[model samples]
Target: MLPDALRSRLALARRSLLPCRGCLGPVGEGAEAGLCGRCWGGLLPLPEGRCPRCALVHAEADCPEATAWDCGDALWDYHGGRPPLGALLLPGIKQGEAGWRKALLGRVLRGPLPDWAAEVDCVTAAPSAWPHRLLRGFDLSAEAARLVAGRLDRPFTPLLAKGWLRGRQASRTESQRRRLPKRAIGLRRGAAPRGLILLVDDVWTTGTTLLRCAQALRAGGADEVRVLTLFRAL
Candidate 1:
């Protein structure tokens, strides 16, 4: 039998060769996310009933962590839509599928910054551990933050750094995630955060990472912090 890792790679390889999920048109050779440019350009808006602050779908519009930041919003439901773009693409991006970055960025660029995002004087991102960055060959949150900065006409600042020994959030349970040490993430040396800040991340799963980075920014001297994530996990 094929190993699980090899099986997943074979599946992704096959999926890459299929026609675009949206239009059933032939995708480019070696396409990632199984979508053509036109189809990718046509991704729809996120479904409704999300917390305006946290971006997660909840019974109440305001999630318990809604108040953790000055304000925040996300682009799409992590597990929504027929293609489930978030579910389909993010894992690949996180695992170093650099080719998928362009497709994902195109989708995110379609969602303009909210009115509140205009007030952000500076843009920054939640830190991915240096090891993960090395393994993945890119950091989605950081790259997306750069795109957001360009869209906002703001400067992207490297605000926080993750401790070398910290664990990956994806591998942890909810309780362990909530108990993440304060030292796991913190202000970057020589960084002087100021005015209103926008904290960017790839996905908002538990809201723990964004909240922690916001706290770091505020504690480091930012007057206020707002967050914008690409997708919100259910």
Candidate 2:
């Protein structure tokens, strides 16, 4: 028997007439695993034996982003499989769709924390431009970080600050995004998180932003950094 919370989500997914992704739906029988689109979309397990840090099915040569973290992981691989259902998850949160927050945190609880995650000392987030934060109901990264912190019983702090006038990174081309200025992100004044820090963000596109946040933490003297995003764009 499912818990009340899960029972309700499953019921709602059944009510949504949208076609399911693969095995998740097409009406009829009730059981766990594949109920409907939202249920499946809301919880995509990380790729088997792959890694989120590089969004790779297998890291061949050393990934360039490895330099910035002790360990990094995300809940879902944005491009891990066909049709790219993972890609839509981030926008649901950014657009302030109802229940997206709870749905995201639900992903975080899908499995036990990875062995590497046990060492995270503090939780912080990649800073978002203020206007985007306001438009999105709050800084998505910050809210995600707070949820992680609460679960881990660690302190959640705003240690990174984004440039005041910077425009949305999504509006820029891949080259433009990679060229994001180093100074575009920096440690907030007086913020000095020691030991391992977990950096949370909404999505990992080029990883330029997440790495930038990790870089800032290292510059401010954090011993190590780990990265977590709700979704990882492969």
Candidate 3:
């Protein structure tokens, strides 16, 4: 991370070269976040009862009636056009801009999450398949977990690894995404943690990944597993 003095100097340089698109006013210092405070309200959280499993805004409560998807609700719907995500996800993860990591951590800290998250024993990120990490150059989920743990003042454990032979999640369908194989996650070599666990991720589309993570944590002796994600795809 850049020191505070250097970051302030960089923000000053950015203000000179960039202005707020909303007001066309010179974005004073610390406005690289792009939008001024007035324009930030549009990103406020929506109410629940969308998808009980993922907290997505569904047209009706009983979504996809035939399929019985069971899991704790998510915070937002990421599949929908959540414009702010472009400012956060693509650049930070795919492009390796570490600055967005802190920005995203700030958002999650301010966003809706279970009260239990504050009391968990430790935090961990959903394991990504080896191929995706190799191709993407960075593991966005793991990075987000570290940020959340820092903000929440909780331990961040690197206790999970991806299943053997599974590939990138982007290529899989909703059905195929469920039912993670037994090889999907394994504990790191250490004494098993005995209390609650918080799993962090960048986005929650169907929650197939989080559910599998919770299952793995339970098998490894974690008493409880809670999930926190930056966005939920409605």
Candidate 4:
């Protein structure tokens, strides 16, 4: 039998020759050649008509509640029609697939950022509950935050700390999520930085957790707080 390292290398080589994950089609040449042209075209962009404050898609005839954070943007909308690249990679990321995580981070780094993001003075992440982090063997939000900080040339700091596991937000309904209190997340004492702050997370479902983190940052003296996520459940 082939040695494990050789087998792994062979597998990687085979995968490199296969169709791209997004469109299951041939990957054409270029900087983005690893991803097929069709799939690259399919990748969703943040809607231009979203709410200015929360980045929620809004119609001309409708208005959303006042958001707690200053402003936010997401790489893709997570609901309706076919799943986007972020959704396709989420399961692997949750299962601690290093390659998938790296791909997701790269996508985030190359994706568009809100105009105000340029003014962000520092970067941070919404804290993952310790229990969840232990189960996954990685902190998804922290990893994304670190990569985003690197791309932005800003400091990545652990500004918020999860006090306890309030149970998985994914398992809860919208009403249940709305009932979750602001205290579910707390700001790390003395860790909050002055000036504009950018908070990163892997996904946005109910917006409860991000709101709590933003509130904590505000309490800790952040001049402004903004959120950026890989995907937002619509």
Instruction: State each model's C-alpha RMSD to the native.
Output: 7.2, 5.7, 5.6, 3.7
Worst ten-residue run, lDDT, model 3? 65-74
lDDT of each: 0.79, 0.72, 0.64, 0.76
Clashes of each: 0, 0, 9, 0
What range of 10 consecutive residues in model 1 has the weakest lDDT sum?
Answer: 38-47
Please provide, for model 1 over 1-234, each residue's C-alpha lDDT reduced to its tens digit, 9 standing for 90 to 100: 999999999987887678785557788753446667654543445557656676655676446663557477877667665566677678867766666778788756767667899888999999999988887788888989999899889999999999978878988999999999988999988999999999989888888888788888888899998888888776
Candidate 2: where is the Cα deviation over 4 Å? 1-42, 51-55, 58-61, 64-66, 80-83
Best by lDDT: 1
Which candidate model has the greater lDDT, 2 or 3?
Answer: 2
Q: Estimated TM-score per prediction?
A: 0.81, 0.79, 0.67, 0.81
Kindly give the stretch of ten consecutive residues in candidate 4 with the minimal lDDT sum: 30-39
Off by over 4 Å in 3: 1-42, 49-53, 57-92, 97-99, 109-113, 130-137
Query: What is the C-alpha local distance difference test score of candidate 4?
Result: 0.76
Residue pairs clashing in model 1 are none
